[model samples]
Target: MTTTTPRLTGEYAIDPAHTRLGFVARHAMVTKVRGSFHEFEGTAHLDSEDPGNSRARVTIKAGSIDTGNQQRDQHLRTNDFLDVPNHPEITFESTRVRQVGTNEYHVTGDLTIKSTTRPVTIDFEYTGSAVDPYGNLRVGLEGSVAISRKDFGVNWNAALEGGGVLVSDRILLEFDISAIKQK
Candidate 1:
């Protein structure tokens, strides 16, 4: 029998319905454009007692990018941006996890996009945990990290008539995770 209030440890799967894998970027050097991937899967091995033993992995379908704009979404999948046809997925693999403060952690991982990989460290906060109606132990976490899109081989831009570029170089990756305990 599974305990309703189990400790946050062991393997778990990220619940897609309750999770958000999104990104934000400055548009026209003035406003921000937000979008999220509609398809992704993630898993984690949580060791709350010894954070160093914790790790996570995620895979996002590149073509699943959505910004509520059909034309723009299609363009984003071209060679100028994600090039989804060539690179169908973006992935992350945590290399280290450390507890920084109460219910807070820093996760350093290798992020791959468009065949380019870079190390990124994201700060995550534990929101809370609960046992759902299905008797599943769920844990909540939120995190974000900023990265230069050019660094990931996503260097596409349009020059503005006045100044600056259409899309900012830095892109903020966001994560809202609700994971179900598997063990």
Candidate 2:
């Protein structure tokens, strides 16, 4: 096969093995904590020529959160945080996709966590594309968005010894995606 400009007008599915759904938040007003959800699936329809016509959707399992520490990860699943039992899934559905600059996009959508839905905009940069050994066309992208945990009904927190809280109110949601074009 000859290498050429990657097509951005087809449907694609996120390759879980090459994608990461993660987050970062301040811990105890000092350090930062990073974690990721191991289970998720997403798809997108690209229309590079008409970016506004593009769309994407994703669903993540709340119980799949991994923070390196088992105890803390479990705690996050409790009512104080994710309340995974009550809300088994976190989801996002893009309402608009706009190309802001060369290979840059602003995706505005409704993000639902713990059954509460709110609008958010995630800025993404298209990393590039390639054809894998198996003849699969893949596209890469990285993006992130900051959001308030409290707004998602995850109001759990504890006061630190000196000042501030155990976890920061602001959370950074990150996405590293490698999507394979669907035939």
Candidate 3:
């Protein structure tokens, strides 16, 4: 017989300092570039009795995109890419959550980028839960989802001399989230 672990029910605010909002994209069709956003905020409300009742939301500052190279980062914020001047934020709001397996969940949400909104489903694993030294309750979750850049209106690309595009259309969004349960 298998025993089920009870879910932790509460409202939690994502800890930006301990959380990583990162992404991976193929560069030049031969290499992968990893980058992360430095500024973002998110919250999650979990329902212990009904996981499907859980909800989450997040907002990221498009200008905070950093891939180590200053020139490349700046280019990402321009009209050819993110167009941070016009679309300053990328947001996500969960519409549904379902348990797919032990410690795993499928979260469906609306992701908005640039001027487009698309539905995305991210698979998340409940890594763990614990009490911090500061006497705070915390939960950890890890998840990722792949999205098409063109679907979000980010259509800029360069052709390589030998053929193929400079960047891949697929982008992987990763989350390593640590959230503190509110009292």
Candidate 4:
């Protein structure tokens, strides 16, 4: 006889319009280049009483990268950076969630960029949960992670006469996501 597993309920899908997947990197050793993913999707599954059991996944379309400059965005999608033609998407899948405080967690996951999967940890915060005006159960989450661009094969650079590189290797990822519960 086949048995049915109990439906695991706290399912939610990311609200793409309201969610932001942003990144910041030092530019020209004097400024910062800030950009966001224009197309992405994510989901969250959590237990109301025990958020430690939560699971999450996010997928980002490489071509949707935008920094408010069309030329720069195109360059970023080329071989010098994301190489969108060869690597269509970047993805993250949580492997574990460790609660370190009342509302803080270290979310460890596998982040795949340009087909290379690496382990990453994000400092996460569960803001709260609420029922929106549309009657959808929603949850808010925020997190940040820092990673080296070179680690993901984006090694393009230019040396400046002043002795610094045109870009910094470290990139900071920031996320403010909201997900609507599944019926």
How many residue pairs clash in model 1?
0
Q: Give the alpha-carbon lDDT of every model.
A: 0.92, 0.92, 0.92, 0.86
Q: For candidate 4, give the lDDT.
A: 0.86
* Model 3 misplaced stretches (Cα beyond 4 Å): 1-7
| Residue range 1-183, candidate 4, lDDT tens digits | 001122334788999998999999998899999999989998877664555587889999999998999998999999999999999999999988877776677889999989888999999886877778898977777999999988988999999998999989999999998889899
Write down the worst ten-residue block by lDDT for model 2. Answer: 1-10
Candidate 2 per-residue lDDT, tens place, 1-183, comes to 012242657899999999999999999988999999999999999876687888999999999999999999999999999999899999999999988878889999999999999999999998988889999989899999999999999998888889889999999999999999999
The residue pairs in collision within model 4 are none
Regions of candidate 2 where Cα sits further than 4 Å from its true position: 1-6
Estimate TM-scores for all models.
Answer: 0.96, 0.96, 0.96, 0.93
**For model 1, what is the alpha-carbon lDDT of residue 104?**
82
Tell me the deviation in Å of residue 135 in model 3: 0.8
- Candidate 1 vs candidate 4, TM-score winner: 1
lDDT tens digits, residue span 123-157, model 1: 99988888899999899999999999999999999
TM-score of candidate 1 versus the correct structure, residues matched by position: 0.96
